[model samples]
Target: MKKIILGIILLFNFSLVAQNPILDIHTADFANIENAYYKDIDNFYNQFVGTWIYTDSVKIIRFKFVKKEMFYRQSIKSCYVDYLVGEMQYVENGVEKINSLINLNINHSEIYNYNLYSYGKTNKDWYPKCLECPDTIERLPMSYNEPTNDDAGLEAAFVMHRADENGVEKIKIQYIETIGAYGIKPDGSPSITTNFTIPYGDYILIKEN
Candidate 1:
């Protein structure tokens, strides 16, 4: 009728500019993916400042990280994703609230030696898989354990420095408790303490040599 009503108003302005996530930059969808996901989470906490340790049977905590910040996504369309949150102001209740809940999601692969490792999708319920496990969105030599007998359990106990089988410098000690079977010891061997009532969740990933 009049060029079909100007081609239906230019297809409704291209579907409202492809559902506006900051005018859709080729498809990050939402004002430049929350500033490219917090500039890769401030370069992954400035390469995780330094020091981190977590163990259990009662306690052992050391996380002395200093810099981390990102929390800007008030309603850029509200699909609920806009954070790079950090700044634990040093420990208070252990591992600075589990390393600010180790929530990362930006790993645009490039054979990284840590080139902004992990790109998108690591928000594993934000604490409470015993506080983020399977080391959610993993990369750097990740590890996890849980199994103190609902099917078998033991949760954790590590001291790896492997080489054995002939290269020998070995010093292994893995006893991940309670998600299933787990046991391995050789750090001066002879250990046996198994008991699990179930309610486990473990996480590990270390490679900062």
Candidate 2:
């Protein structure tokens, strides 16, 4: 009886401390993964971290980004992931309309705790699809949620690109919006209109630091 009890304890401890297979996010299959840690082993998330700004005569916007590591994600199964979380500040016509960047440095317990968050490395293929983006280059995809978009009835996918623009480093974000088949209504009907306040188009941002 004593020996049986000892063996059980040993097995349990091993399971708890056992290292899960670590995978690079670029080529990972996000589903059906069990006890695996999706890692940014190459530090791909670093380049996008920090402050990026976009400005025109009328509109000025800034996006602040940071990498949050080893977040527990619940899907069909439980897995650990590394990803980017972001906050935005928007101004148009000299009036500040939105700003959520104040809490960017404070790590939230959940990704959805923020307005924008996503995981995945440079992706070769994505949905709502990238039209002008070349297949040869991979882009980082992120999903955005506005606090007032409780029933916005639209999908906003923003993909990031890094390149040299006129001898300066710039990040290009393509904001692609898509309409879904479902709605917030209990009757299972889509919303008749959208409540999107953000502008739609490509934004060119410069690194602030």
Error (Å) of candidate 1 at residue 46 is 2.9
Which whole-number lDDT from 0 to 100 does residue 96 have in model 2? 88
In angstroms, the error of model 2 at 4 is: 22
Measured by lDDT, the strongest candidate is 2
Model 2 per-residue lDDT tens digits across residues 1-209: 99999999999877765756677766778645787888888887787888899999899989988988888877767788888889888889989888888877677777787877765755546754557667776678887866556554566778886755787868888886776424564355555536456697888899986
State each model's CA lDDT, in order.
0.31, 0.76
Deviating ranges (above 4 Å) for candidate 1 = 1-42, 45-47, 52-58, 63-121, 124-142, 145-178, 182-209
Alpha-carbon RMSD, each predicted model: 17.2, 5.0
